[model samples]
Target chain A: MKAFETYHPIVLFAYFASVIGLSMFYMHPVYLLITCIGAITLNLLLNRKSFISGLKFFLPMFFIAAIINPLISHDGEIILFYIDYNPITLEAIVYGFAMSIMICSVIFWFGCYNVVMTSDKFLYLFGKVSPALALVISLTLRLVPRFKHQITVISHAQKTIGMDISAGNPWQRVKSGIRIISILITWALENAIETADSMKARGYGLKNRSTFSLFVFEKRDGFLLGIILTLLFINILGSYFGVTTYYFYPTFTELTVTPISIGLYISYASLLVIPIVIEIREAIKWRSLKYNM
Target chain B: MQAQSTARADIYSRKRLIFSSIIIFVVIPIIMLIGVTIFNDRKYNLISMIIVLLACVPFFVSFERRKPQAREILTIAVMSAISVAGRAAFIWIPAFKPVTAITAITGFAFGAEAGFLTGATSAIASNIFFGQGPWTPFQMFTWGILGFIAGLLGQKGWMKSKIALIIYGVFAGIMYSFCMDIWTVISYDGLFSWKRYLIAMSTAIPFTIVYVISNVVFLLVLAKPIGEKLERIKVKYGMLNN
Candidate 1:
């Protein structure tokens, strides 16, 4: 699918603001779950193809987040099981689940951002800060699939020579795998050095690095930014007033879902939705532009 | 036949360099680092740091080559970073609680180099919030080795099976504890006593079980999907040799 379609910068900005806003304020499992669902739904609708493509990266992350978070955090109540007298509490489980949802949601949002923001948008946002660093970030995003491709080719070639990593004893297999990584690492570093040389040759990071952006701040962008600012204000106020507060000491206090809390949650959830809204507006604008042409 | 033979030889030579570099740089140094930290009474904190710094030598040397191109290098670095960060972020999630498992998955999906980099990078970077200490290198080496081994297992297809992944997780957990025990011995100036070792191992046992279980669950859930994605990436990028 197309990586970047025209959307108001405010929409993207607001979306990010909300995500950061929610993550900072809330600690409830329910709130995290709802936010995650909202993120997945928005991602699927706005960029269905990229969402699927991102699963390669996201699926493993989901499991990793879901499994390993609870073990380290052993401070919860309602012990589920005891191993060697160490209580595995339900509090830990709930807390872990909440954490996994938060992690996965953030990742999903980032993936969505990667598609929508594009290199051009990133250039627009951070070009002034450091062009060299921005270029590196952009180039890296474009490079993930490329690296994956190389590993496959190398593995296949190795396999033909009876070095198939998958067809070995466990120890031998581990050794073979290390062999592949060494090759890849060597290849990657070599590529980086060459790139550094090329950049130097081209005067990259010279006295002044010039940049251009295809984005122009429009009326919609302003409106979107205004909404985002309001949301940010609300989030800040909520946090300041302790609207999203919870306690895990003495005994676990279930988060009170007050009207203010609900409002905070809704506003934060709306942040993720902003991107989809921007995408829809852009799609309509493109259609109208096409008709005029 | 001659042309094919030449192409095959080129591939073979490339493989040889890759294998040698891994042995000399990644594997050997890791063993030595563990050995020095465990067996010697010397201040290994500085030496461990040097070993980590030295590890970058191969990366710097290899990156000098022209074949993989700028885009490919950036891609590898970013993905490696993402995988590392992703695994580390699991710690922030309170429910899943499987540190050992996550470590293994990082190793499995990325391979030893990526695994090592991820482990070391996570330990170093996470210290920004978690606070840094003498334990950083040891943690790096422990997790890095876990990831390295995971990658090795993935390459062998052992990571694909449930039982194998579980076994690997247990092995990784035990190995990590053993390695850390050695570090404690060096750092604390404890007698090379079985009681100290047992105490260290016992303290880590609960976490190890959690680690093993987590590793198993992670492998069961993500190994196949990540593998497929890696394959797709290979094809899309023309990484496969014709």
Candidate 2:
């Protein structure tokens, strides 16, 4: 893990929320290309093994999302072909491809988010703002993997008793699975009840209780957050004011590279590449230290 | 087996729900549409979406405050977790989902309001494991509606039959794909076009069929035991008296 990974969880979450928000809120093709490359690269850098494995899921999603646009959108400037008496346009196809990349890359970023935003980080981020809802959401996010593990254990135990879901005929197996689930539901409710009672006994939600957290916002984190927000604000302002606008409708507009847009582009790129830059800097420092050693 | 004591407490909740549903599902879109007509700008769609998502906060706040017992709140959380996990369990099966079945049952046992919250919550929560995007809010609303219908209609005489549940599953499957297809159509064309929507629907029929099969399969497998357990919990705890 890089030094960036060890920052206060709130800093990390704010970075993600801002970055992902940019991906969704900004539709400029240039901005999108930068986002696509940055998200995928950072993701691969984070974990190459998982990134490759995720290709099996992301490729199809990209293609489907990309292809569907040209199929339905016939209002583009460059008509490519006619399918079922409707015109398919090159502009639409290109727009669709951009959109798909936008979606897939955001998904890649979220895949990274899943890795970095552990349950503790998630709880800390929301706990201060909305305690009750945060507590519930953290519990739910935490429970999912636990529930999956429970399913495996239950299925294993059932198999030992000759009541495996995979063993019986289809209907009988389904029935058997439900029987297992019946046991699981009882367990789940009882488990939740016990948790609730435990919290109650601990004086939760009864008064203003002070809690301690491990994360403290350092000056480095302050700088990081300030830079991210400043760039994000500038980029959002550019788009919101239509300074970075492009048309893909009845007529496609040329993708102009004006000075202002170029600045916006730089801000957006720098915003996304912050993590990569940090990693590269750390790598150079480590190499220099080794040479000195 | 729902108790009589809670009905008076919940009547206000039901009233507020109906009012908010109209406001969320009907009035907001109409306002956006009117704005579009006045300005001749379709960008109002984003404004409308943001407004509706914000409205969810108040709705949830009401759910939190009026929630009679801590048990029901935890129950909803656990059910949402189960639905998310169930979706993850079927990761190998593309487009197949047990979410609808479970969400539908949550509606059936709980009232329409709880049903909507469960469906919506499950969608958002599961997307954390799957993916979240512009599609998240739409998925939340659509699945919430499906659950509301199941709760509103599923508890009655014929609707309670297994055959009817299967039929509802099939319809729900199509409805989900169709609802999502609107996002496809609008995002593709920048406006809701009938021709585009039709093509989108036709293109997605295969996925819809999988939804049908998966919903039926999972519902058949899940509803009875989960439903039975939920009902027993409700009666034993005197929950959701309305």
Candidate 3:
């Protein structure tokens, strides 16, 4: 429910970079599982309360993913069910489950990031150089909730007028939906005009714009940045040397997993865990401060 | 009276040109990339050069007009990018998968031009992020039409009702699937006969279900919110001509 929470943007950025880097280089099922687990565990640790609250949003999606993914992906070995010529394999099921886990973990991480990395963090990082771009990102984030709220109001108003879209057949429903959207279009255009005028009146882009930053790079940020830079350097080197390679299609073969690959994977997986570590450390620090007081 | 009318008309046409030019410069190359990938099996690197060349057109035209402030233009460009990212989020939503409703909603909210941009951009960008192949443009056009239809219908007030949105979503889904199926046939070419198309349909049935379900869910979650915000924006900004 809170709009923003405190966390280091660099750490979060590093974490995402590492996860993406690892996923690209080392894409084994087992390694993916570890990454997923790490993501979920961190998600739970950081956003326990929000996770509980947001379960409604996530639960239906999880079920849909679990059931639907396996049905669509007709791959893997160890057939479990045979309907007509199609085979539903256990491998496919596990793959789907893993995929769902991966997706959910990513979503949770995004949610955490959204909470922690407020527009201020973005502005802090890139505002000075690209104020216009930073402003747009901030506006977009602000717009999401505003847009959601507006839709609710419009639908309610329409319902009162007996134009209930939910009460109709499929074809009629489409017609009615178009009508509502037309209204929305007019509204959005008008809003854009007002935004343009307001921004103009305020003398935006009059000269080179300077941005204000709230976050001062501290010792912890420096330490985390150094770790991230080293890890990224290592990851780049690994990729450059052709350390991780796998072939699919004509035949599937796994290249020998070197110590470097394992080390990189661990580092990548641990990157996602860093936020949770920071949160725990913060909680401990807060508790000690309270005790001393 | 004739002279006055001519002057007003000239101004209006000039405004339209400015707007259209901006859109063309920003959106056309993105579309061309999709076109090349679908029609020809070329990699995406080729499109980057095209983008650079095409991007200069907008800068030149905008610089010529000098009516709309640089910040205003930048804001539009930035909004366009965010819209692209938002549309991409729907794909990453996992359960939603790839559905026509996103195209429809985008088209309905932004208009045909923006809808086209959203459709094409989402297709290309998602493919690039996930992994690109030849089918990218086909998917782009398919989704682009969904938005185009939504915008076209929305402009006529057809998308105002919930029933209409749902129906539009379903129709868009069907159109998308049908188009994708055609592309499959084209890709397979000689290997896929008339009978194979039928077989392919049967195979694609599950995906069709997912598409429909995603469309329905997306409309249910998004329609009302998008509608109201857009209305507010319209009123506040004086966007529509009466």
Best candidate (score: DockQ): 2
Instruction: Kindly report which residue stretches of model 2 are placed more than 4 angstroms away from their true locations once superposed.
Output: A56-90, A145-172, B1-52, B131-134, B154-159
Docking class of 1: incorrect
Decide which is better by DockQ, 2 or 3: 2
Cand. 2 Cα-lDDT: 0.77
| Model 1 residue B51 distance off true place after TM-score fit, in angstroms | 25
Instruction: Give residue A276's error in model 1 in angstroms.
Output: 3.0
Task: List model 2 lDDT by residue over B105-211, tens digit each.
Answer: 88888867677778888886787777555677778877888888888875563456789889989999999998887765655444577997887788788999999
Per-residue lDDT over B1-242 for candidate 3, one digit per residue giving the tens place of the 0 to 100 score: 66885686467557757765766765876566564544232222224323433533332333234343433433333334434444554655543553355556656765654455445545544443343333455776666566667778877877878788778767776667776776444332212346546756777777777777778777766677665665555455434221
Q: Cα deviation in Å at residue B222, candidate 3?
A: 16
Per-residue lDDT of B166 in model 2: 90
By DockQ: ranked, best first: 2, 3, 1
Q: Pick out the ten consecutive residues of candidate 1 chain B with the lowest summed lDDT.
A: B59-68
- Lowest lDDT sum, 10 consecutive residues, model 3 chain B, at B41-50
Q: What is the lDDT of residue B128 in candidate 2?
A: 73
TM-score of chain B of each: 0.65, 0.86, 0.63
